[model samples]
Target chain A: MKAIVHVGLKPGVLDPQGKAVADTLGRLGFDEVGSARIGKVIELDLTGDLDAAAAEARVREMCETLLANTVIESYRIELQA
Target chain B: MKAIVHVGLKPGVLDPQGKAVADTLGRLGFDEVGSARIGKVIELDLTGDLDAAAAEARVREMCETLLANTVIESYRIELQA
Candidate 1:
């Protein structure tokens, strides 16, 4: 099974890296771009004989414990068989 | 419109960051975890009057030119209206 986690900053948080990308895009002539926000996607491969529900729960715990800094960031997890 | 880009290392590329995550997970007792790979998710807000097709094409160009390191990374773009 696999767990795909998307971790992103909260809406009100400042994202310097994203701003830099947007600025670079503007300089590159991608004038249509207004803003860019960068985040992380962590993919985990699981080997145990866990069911979908169990995997989702385990992955959620992983996200809370290490994958995401919940104070300023939010994460969404998707599980696949 | 918005474009969500997922950038990840191509298979066989050495990902030390990912290795570190896996090692940490094991230390934290997430024994089911076999491997962990980290990537980037970049969300871009588009302001111009571009149709769906045009937006996708434009985003693809951005990926090829700047957003992705084509030599060792792959990117997938998703556009949302």
Candidate 2:
């Protein structure tokens, strides 16, 4: 099974990197670009015998514990066989 | 309008950050984790008046020209109103 996690800054969080990119885009003539927020995608390939629900639970735990900074970030999970 | 871009390493590309994360997860007891590939998601908020198709095309161009490294990275664009 595979699990894909999208981790992003929480609303109202300051994103320096996003701001930098946005400014760059504006300078590069993409004036239509108002804001650019950057995030992370972690694609995990799982092995061993774990059911879908079990894997999801474990992955969510992992996200909470390490993969995402819960205080400042939010994550979405998608699973595939 | 908003455009979400998912940028990822093309298959066969080496990802040291992903490898490190995978190793760390294994040490932290996620034995089921076989591989972890890390990527980037860029969320762009568009302010100017661009129709859906035009915005997508412009975003795609931005991806190819600046957002993604065409040699090793592939990007997917999703537009939202």
Candidate 3:
């Protein structure tokens, strides 16, 4: 099975990297762009007989413990068999 | 409009960060994990009257020119109104 996680800053959190990108885009002639935010995607390959529910639960644990800060960031997970 | 871009290393590319994550997960007792890969998600807010197709095309250009390093990374773009 495969687990895909998308972790991003929570709303109202400041994102300097994203701000830089947006500013650069404006200078580069992409005037349509108003803002930008950057985040992380982690893909994990698992080898086990666990069912979908168990896998998702385990992955969520991983997020809370190691993968995400949880205070200023939020994460979403997707699983594939 | 909003554009979401997911950028990831190509299949054959080596990802040191992902390897470190996998190793750490193993040490942290996630023995089921076989491997991991890390990627980026960039969200952009756009202000324009352009249609969906046009917005997508413009964002693709942004990816090609600045957002993604096409030599080693591949990117997918999603648009939302």
Candidate 4:
């Protein structure tokens, strides 16, 4: 199985990196861009021993415990086999 | 239409953020963690004007021009309505 974890700063939070990217885009001629919020993608290839839900739960725990700062960021997990 | 752009550091490139996260995870008891590679995800809700491929192309251009550095990162685009 393979899983992808997408983590990002929640709306209304300050994101300096995202702001910098948006600024760079404006300079590059994409003036219509309103905003940019940057985040992280963590992809993992796992063995097939665990059921999808179990694996997802494990991943969720990983995110809550270590992968993301739940106070300022949120994460979504996608499972692929 | 809605689109998602996932950008990440390419393998073999140095990923200090990923390393830092992995180190943090290990300290937090996820010793099974092998490696961590950090990236970014951009989700956009768009109007219904452009076709999926066209929007994807625009996003790819954006990634190349602003969202990602071709030297160290690669991107994937997903479209939804």
Best by TM-score: 3
iRMSD (1 decimal) for each model: 0.7, 0.7, 0.6, 3.2
Per residue, candidate 2 scores C-alpha lDDT tens digits across A2-79 of 999999999999999999989988888999999999999999999988898999999999899889999999999999
What is the CA-based DockQ of model 3? Answer: 0.90
Give the alpha carbon lDDT tens digit for every residue of A1-81 in model 4. 767898889888999977887777778876545666677788765554778898898778889987879999989999887
- State how far residue A50 of model 2 sits from its true place (Å): 1.5
Candidate 3 has an lDDT of: 0.96
Ranking by lDDT: 3, 1, 2, 4
Counting clashing residue pairs in each candidate, in order, gives 0, 0, 0, 0
What are the clashing pairs of model 3? none
lDDT of 3 at A37: 100
CAPRI verdict (incorrect, acceptable, medium, high) for model 3: high
Residue A67 of model 1 has an lDDT of 93
Q: Please list the residue runs of candidate 3 whose C-alpha ends up more than 4 Å from where it truly belongs after superposition.
A: none
**What's the TM-score of chain B for every model shown?**
0.95, 0.96, 0.97, 0.89
* Residue-level error in angstroms, candidate 3, position B4: 0.6
Residue B24 of model 4, lDDT score: 75
